[model samples]
Target: MKKAWIIWLASTLLLAAALHVAFMFAYPYILMNAAMDRLSANGERENVWTHAPRMTETARLIVRPSPDLAYSSCVYDLSDGPVQISVQPWGDYMSLSLFGANTDNYFTLNDRRMPESGAIVILRTADQAITDEQRAAAFEVVDSPSARGIALVRRLAPSPERFAEAEAARVQEECRALNAE
Candidate 1:
């Protein structure tokens, strides 16, 4: 009876371990897909920035969104080619962050680190090639572990008045296919 009970306990632990590992691997992908779907629900195309209104109590598009920050997001799909992202600085604090499909934040650039002209980044898949022209351009090139990911911009807007300035800065932000032109 003692041996049988020990075996049962071991089996239960193994099953629990397997389940935990599975959930860890799957949750991020599931969450990211849902976020993408919600972001594009309005017939918005990929590689285009969608500006979100100031965060209110009803805002639920993102988990734990900051009420003091304005957000703009782009669901990037790089299967066809590279995408170009431009962010204009606004307020005292602004940041651009890139997240992989698995919810890993692989890149982040803040306004303090950005040039006075703003930030221009080219995001491409690992297999994609960068042309000589792109390499020579002033923009920085980054590699995406997955073809699909999210680019998010956050600008500090502590008040309703500052939120309007954040919105104006978001208007100058751009996310588009590099080859579109």
Candidate 2:
């Protein structure tokens, strides 16, 4: 009876460990899918920037959003083709970050690293071939691990006045499929 009880306890622990590992591996993908669905719910096309209004207590688009920052998000689907992203500099603090389908942030550019003219990047899947035109465009090319992902832009707007400026500057930010135009 003692040996049987010990074996049962060990089996239960192993099952729990496996379950935990599975959840850990799946949670990021699950969260990202939900976010993508929400972002695209309005029949908006992919690779278009969606500028989010300043985070308010009522805003729930993102988990624990900072009320002081202005945010924009783009749900990119590179299956059709590579996408071009352009982020316009705003204020003293601004950043652009790219995350894969699994929520892995593979690239980030901040104001300090960006040029005065702003930053432009082309995102393509590893298997996608870069065209001569694209190569000659003199833009930074990034190989995405997954064909679908998210690009997020953040700008510090700690005050209402600064938030207004951030909102205005966000107009210049853009993301679009390279083949579209």
Candidate 3:
């Protein structure tokens, strides 16, 4: 039971040294289904529910938008649900997030510096060992993921335009204050 509620933070050292000769966006049905069903079953009717479970992997389901989550889009909200998915803000590298209730352990896709409240995204690289295009988003710089896999977007942030706006406002406010004063 304890194993089903653990989340670990990966180190950046190993993440940087690792070479991505091939990249792929294979959304393991297990991770998505398991997280959805478990969360819905435990949450209110507004949330999504699932019956199937995820495959095996030494992974951690990272990424979230606070613990008030109750829905499932392209990505899973790690705060609630049966398993605890620890999410950090994405600074430089993109990642893939996986969630499983059986071994209920959430972590990054073999990396560190996870996003704080957004989709676990990845960009196109020379990683031939991987094959999921949706994982790579070198083209669709506006959407969630690349091609094959679904890019997780923040529900709080509306679609079709800029991502963060409050920051811009803050900057503008500062400028105005400086000029007026």
Candidate 4:
């Protein structure tokens, strides 16, 4: 009888311990599954950050010295290819960027001339046929051996005016393309 009681008590304790462990593991999973199900049920909602619709981020143009003309001109581009703009991820505004290609050295807009507080550096669309004057006046020299890009910071969000339907569609299309791949 005494042996039977000890065994029974031990079994009860073991069962209780197992139940505790099981609850610890299963409770969160159930909660997460339910949460995900709820979110999926409401997946049709659309907003600015929603993934289903398209969005455009920004448009960049390349600037280069023009062979025929004496000034640099920006060739407007639709950004059909993947373009990467590199900038330090700190601060409220963009100070430097590596225009079209990463191999192109990073340029700081405030290269030698100081920019007023809110001036934006614009690069032309094409890589060739830019005039020296356009290169000098239209685009800011972000990086040079001379003074530039020292205080330039990064801007994660552009001005509201920069957002457009075409840009949003491109972003959405890119996301869809990436998801398909």
Q: Write candidate 1's Cα lDDT for 73-160 as tens digits.
A: 9999999999999998664899999999998999999988898878789999988988888766735899999988899998889899
User: If the candidates were sorted by their lDDT against the true structure, best first, what order would they fall in?
Assistant: 1, 2, 4, 3
For residues 22-141, what per-residue lDDT tens digits would candidate 2 score against the true structure? 999999999998898787664375899998888999998889999988899999999899999988877588899999999999999899988888878989998888788876673589
Which wins on TM-score, candidate 2 or candidate 3?
2
CA lDDT scores, all candidates in order: 0.89, 0.87, 0.28, 0.30
Model 1 misplaced stretches (Cα beyond 4 Å): 1-16
Residue-pair clashes per candidate = 0, 0, 32, 22
lDDT, residue 59, model 2: 97
Query: What clash pairs does model 2 have?
Result: none
TM-score, candidate number 3: 0.20
Off by over 4 Å in 3: 1-38, 42-97, 109-112, 115-132, 138-181
**What's model 4's lDDT at 100?**
22
Model 3, 28-106: lDDT tens per residue? 4445445444444433321121211121243224443332221122323222211112223333333433333322333
- Highest lDDT against the true fold, candidate: 1
- Could you report the Cα RMSD, in angstroms, for every candidate shown? 2.4, 2.4, 20.1, 19.0
Alpha carbon lDDT of residue 5, candidate 1? 100
